[model samples]
Target: MEKLHKPKKVFVPGAISPQFIADSIAKHQSKVNIGAHAIFLGQIRADEKAEGFVTGIEYSAYEEMAEQTFHEIREDAFSKFDLICMHIYHSIGLVPTGEISLFVFVSSGHRRAAFEASEYIVEQIKTKVPIFGKELVGPAGEYIWKENK
Candidate 1:
């Protein structure tokens, strides 16, 4: 987490661009305090349902609540680990299957801390955040509500 900074909007309008991820990593190289970084990218999957295969997902969230929940998650992660920086991004609009949606990156002084913190953030976001998504299926455009199983 950056010091003396306002909270950033986490939701992207569509699939997370690859260039954005690359740029983020590149920016961290100048920070000599960070020894290890862990990244987790959650992609939309083309899951086969009874009706057909999932083509895309449209995500929405309770923005005010989700942001607050994310802030708490970040603070907890920092207390539990020696973290230098952390970033979380989730796609908001339509994301095609196989495209990235959620990205969690954690930087720490050691690999262990980075790995654990990154994993923790991803799991907590999935379970705790009030983000809803619809799975648009097949050519017919049938839709189903998406939930973590």
Candidate 2:
């Protein structure tokens, strides 16, 4: 396994704008000799369940732990794959239904590495991070946090 590098910044906040993420990626491109860029956007879904309709989502995280985990993930991605650069951002607090919950972007010198690294970053986020999210449902809604599968 390759050593991981920490991202320049990581935050667990109330909301995030897609434009902000795009801007951040643009800033990182200066030294990136990237020929390919791939991105993954995760949106909150309104799920209809036996109980009722899921209206929105609220996210939370162990920030210190998540950042450390994210740093390791970044380092591993750089060492294992030939990526020029990569970024990951996730929303915290109350994210309205249908809004984006997470964003992962990867850039590389070639198409293959960008695509692969994009997938790797997301998979690592889902399985390794200490972030948690709760699903809010119905008028008298209940909040359900995600459990590891």
Candidate 3:
């Protein structure tokens, strides 16, 4: 019997569209016996803070490190959960406020696994990956890096 390999994790230094994520999920279905799929989309929010009105977000990452970290996270999730399939994507460039910045999708034989895995992926990305984003704000265009705090 052939062993099943995990789905490829994609990293692009460009804009991310919802269509791209949907396509990825569709392609992974053959390896999954999914009865439930859960997705989480993180959008750039315009924050009105003490600094000023947030305009957009510009993202950056330590690509090599981020990729390695993501791969490890994927393996951990597969081993820890009963998920059949999963994918995670995050924008690396400028993303306008209200646009999707991160997307996570998970499929499982049942709803509970799907839901829990989806949450786990997002949390891992935020804490483990070297990706960071700067919140562009104010009429004069100031930028501040966003931290987990």
Candidate 4:
């Protein structure tokens, strides 16, 4: 059996911050070889429910399984696309409706690979990961289990 690459940490304790994102981008400025970058940020939405309106999302996951799935997704993307860099971060706790819960970044020598890889990574995460969310709604703080649409 071939050895799999060790999984990197993909889960954050809370919402992904704008400053962290900005710093990530700024760090890549030194990589002159990268010509194109694609970024995707998944924000918690204020979707109206029958009981109330969504104020935030409380996220949870099977950490071990999710990490392995993430590693596989990364490997598949690298094999399928000529990517120079890729990152995936997901919130593991409460993230306000306007705050970012997920962040995906991909880079390549050209635009197409970066864009395609970015999309692929996001789609794979949505479909394959074991992450779950509880949508915290309204003033009463009632929550409904969220399903990916």
Best lDDT among the predictions, by candidate number: 4
Q: Give lDDT per model, in order.
A: 0.89, 0.79, 0.80, 0.92
Residue-level lDDT tens digits of model 2 in 1-149: 45545355666476668778768777866765778888898887788866677787787888888888888888888887898778778888888777777888888889999988888888998899888878887778888765444
- The TM-score values for the models, in the order shown, are 0.94, 0.87, 0.86, 0.96
Backbone clash pairs for candidate 4 read: none
Worst 10 contiguous positions by lDDT, candidate 1: 1-10
Rank by TM-score, highest first.
4, 1, 2, 3
How far residue 146's Cα lies from its native spot in candidate 2, in Å, is 2.9
lDDT of 4 by residue, 1-149 (tens): 23245568999999999999999999999999999999999998999999889999999999999998899998888888998888899999899999999999998999999989998999999999999999999899998999898
Give the per-residue lDDT of model 1 (tens digit) for 27-109.
99999999999999999889999889999999999989988788888888888888999999999989999999999999999
Cα-lDDT of candidate 4: 0.92
Q: Which ranges of candidate 4 are over 4 A from the true structure? A: 1-5
Shift of residue 62 alpha carbon in model 4, Å = 0.5
Q: Which regions of candidate 3 fall more than 4 Å away from where they truly are?
A: 1-9, 25-32
Of candidate 2, the 10-residue stretch with the lowest lDDT total is 1-10
